[model samples]
Each structure stands twice: as structure tokens, then as C-alpha cells.
Target: MTELGYAQAPAVAAREGVPRPCLGCGAPMAVTADAQLHADATLTCGFCGRSETMPAQAAAQDRYLRLRLMQVRRAREGMEAPLKTYEMMRASGVFALIVFGAQGGWMLWGAFTTADKGSAVFGMLGAAGMMGVILANFGMMRAFRKLIKPLQQARPPAAPGLAARCRSCGGDLPPVRSTHATCAFCGANNFLDNAAAHDVNALLTAEQQDYKVRASGGKPGDNTIYQRPAHAFYVWGAAGAAVTFVVGVVLVLVLV
Candidate 1:
């Protein structure tokens, strides 16, 4: 024994496999968690009564996982953005329609009553500008449709990853290492010393997976969620419809 009831050998041996050789004795070493589940591995030598602590284990050193997290994209959470947009465009469309109508009336009065070219030209240009606004709003409505479609989709949660690998063999490892694991490729023992980052990450993954499975509207294992339409869709739709009405009126007057 070295200092306490521990062995005099290094905490970990240079070579290894699951049930790695203990430092003091040639017996296999295994890692286990304590009662709290908040600590590192309590490495115990099976042959000799020796113990030591280990660092947090990492996983998937070579390969990478792009995990799409599960989360509910609330419909009302950011409604303000689209709502404000709708209000502005709708107001502009209404103002343009009124201006265009008044200008058209003035231009018609000037044309029949007298050849006052200044008033006629002014009215014509003013009406043209209002018409342009109505057309621009139409284009905005089309783009807004594309934006709202995704809001109708079930949004997955944000996904984040970490750099991980087996401490002993530098091999890929599973997320959960509670009881610990032995590598099949290198026969190296893996520990489940839950570090802060890894513990939270694994817990989140498990919870999200379960949530997706439960929220699914299909079969037992199907993944689905309620997708809400964006508020912007309604807003833009109202503005677009308003502009279309005014444009139709202007066209009728021109044709007449």
C-alpha cells in the first residue's frame, strides 16, 4: 500500500482493458459510482483491497453526432415580430389606396373640366406612386408566405455537442457510463464518472427523446409534435388582401 489503503502504483496503468489490471496486484480493476451519483469513479481492485479515483470519461472521439434536440416551439412566444410587421404594412396599404383614389378623381375632374396640365400631371404621378406601393406590398406577402411555412413545422430544440473519447483506449464510448463499460475493440475499461457537462448533456438527451416519443401523434415510437402557424402569416395575409382590393379598384378606374 502507498499512502492510505491505496496501491503504490500509478492511478491508471499504461495498458488496459475492462477489468484492467490493478496497480498493486495483478487483479482486474473496476470502476463504480458512490451513493450520491455526483462523483468520479471509485476504482477498486478485485484481487487486492486497493482503491483510487478517476477523471470523467469521454466518448465518440473519432465520430461526431449531430443531435436535433426536442423542444416545443411555442406559437405565441415571438408573435410580436410578425404582428408589428403586419400592422405597418396594412397601414401603408390603406394609406396608399386612399391617396390613389383621391388622385384618380382629381385627375378625372381636370381632364373633363379644363386642360389644366399642371394639376393633371401631378395627379397622374401621385396615383402612379400609390400604385407602386400596392405592388410592393404584394411582393412582401409572397415572401412572408415562405417565412410562415416553417412556423407551421414542429421545431426541434437546439443541439449542442462536445469533444469526447475513451480515456483509456481513446475509443468511442456510449453516453451513459453509469455502471461503466468495457471496450470491445481494445478491451479497455471505461468509467462513468459523470462530469458536469456530460451529465447534463446525457440527461437532456434522454428526456428529449422520451418527450418526442410521447408527443408523437402517430404510433408508439413515432416522433411528432403540434406545430402552430406563425402570427406573421395572418398579418401579411391581411395586408396583401387589403392591397389587392385597392389595386383592383385602381385598375377598374383606369379601364373605365
Candidate 2:
């Protein structure tokens, strides 16, 4: 028995239904049985738009429908990649170093000033301020790195075929013989002529699935579907910047 508690081979076969040829492209329609017994059956064709209901004894049809659903689930999961730890650490480290250097410069200038006792007190306060900034910057860097590390480490799915289903028309776009090729359905130019092909993979990492789904499409499920990690990065970066700016203002007012 597999993890779902059914025999793997037969259960899979039971889930998959009969194949029907597509009317548009002659591609085969894959069908599967819905888990809910006695429920109305549905069919989904990966290559064309064709669906039909099956009679009660349509075991083969059920299997085909289930297989299609399985494929979709896998594809959706594959779209979301993972975050890399090294990349997160590197970004955070750079931010920390920059903030630390700036604070250090401010402190060094305070040491050289020749003023009265009040000036000396202010100088000491400035030194303390620099230390506080250094610590705060380091903390911020650590927090940001931790938050995004899991996202960076996610693995992407295998690349799709040259001809992919168009988001707008749901039609396949075949590759051009030449480097410059335009999508037949939508007239969108394929990036073949460019240095790299366009990646249609999902943008969010596996760990951020829940957050991405919620923030983006408001999907009720726990999984997230982001088109790109950079989107998440921008959102996080903006929030972090706003917080840092507010903290810096408070500190400057208190110290100066």
C-alpha cells in the first residue's frame, strides 16, 4: 500500500480513466476517477478543451481524470522554488557592513572635536550611538537573512517544453525555426533571440508557499504561488527599510 493507504499500481490505474483524442490537435485526453464515489465525473484534457461526464461503471474514465489532477498538482508544486541560505547570508552581510561602516565614520569624527564639557558629554553619547547602530544593523541583517533563507534554498521544477500553454489563450506556442520567434496565439515574442530563454517557472520558494499564496491571490489553501522571488524580496525589503528608517530617526533625535 502506498502512503495514501491503497495499493500503488492498481490505485493509480483506478484513478486514471480512458484516453480520448482531442478535437483541435488530436492529442490524447487523459482522464481519472474522482475520489468521491457516486459523484458526477469530470474530464480534463491537457492538450485541448474537451470534458465529458462518464456513466457509473466508467472506471477507466476515473483513472484518466485522476491522472490529470495529479499532473496539475505536481506542476503547481514544481513552480515554487526554494530559497538559498548562502544568497540570503550574502545580502544580509552586505547590508550590515554598509550600515556599520557609516556608523563607525560618525564616531571617528566625534573623537576629533575639541569643545567644552558639554561637547565631551555629547561625544560620549555619539560613541554610544554608534555602538547601538552597529548592534541594531547586525540584528536586522540576521533577522532578514533568517526570514529569506528558506525561500532561497527551494528547488525549481524541470523546464517546460518549448511549446507551452499560453496564459492568455491556453494554446500551445511552438518554437520558431529562427532565433526570433513570436507566439502564434498572442504575438508575444519568444525570448529565443535573447541571451537566455524566459523561465516560466513559479517565483516563490516552497517554504514561502503559504505566505505567497495569501499575499498574492488570496488562495484559501496553505500553499503559495508566486511568479518570482524578486517580488517577495521587494516587498520584504520595503518593509524592512521603513522599519530601519523609523528606528534611525528615533535614535538620531535621542542622541543628538
* Candidate 2 weakest lDDT stretch, 10 residues: 1-10
Query: Which regions of candidate 2 are displaced past 4 Å?
Result: 1-25, 28-48, 53-91, 112-256
**lDDT by residue for model 1 (1-256), tens:** 0111112111222223345678898887775433222334466787788987653442111111101000011212223234345546656777777877687667757754775555555555555555556655665555444554322222111344532344333444455535455433233334444333355556557656756876885335211111112243344445654665466446535543
Q: Assess each prediction's global lDDT (C-alpha) against the native.
A: 0.44, 0.42
Best by TM-score: 1
RMSD score of candidate 2 (Å):
15.6
| TM-score to native of every candidate shown | 0.29, 0.24
Tell me the lDDT of model 1 at 19: 56
The candidate that wins on lDDT is 1
Q: Compared with the true structure, what per-residue lDDT tens digits does model 2 show for residues 1-256?
A: 0122111212233332235666667787654434453344545567666766555566555555445444443453344333233245446655655564555445535534442334434444434444444444455445544553333222222244334433222334454466444333233333332223433344324325755776887756323323224444444544555555456445545655
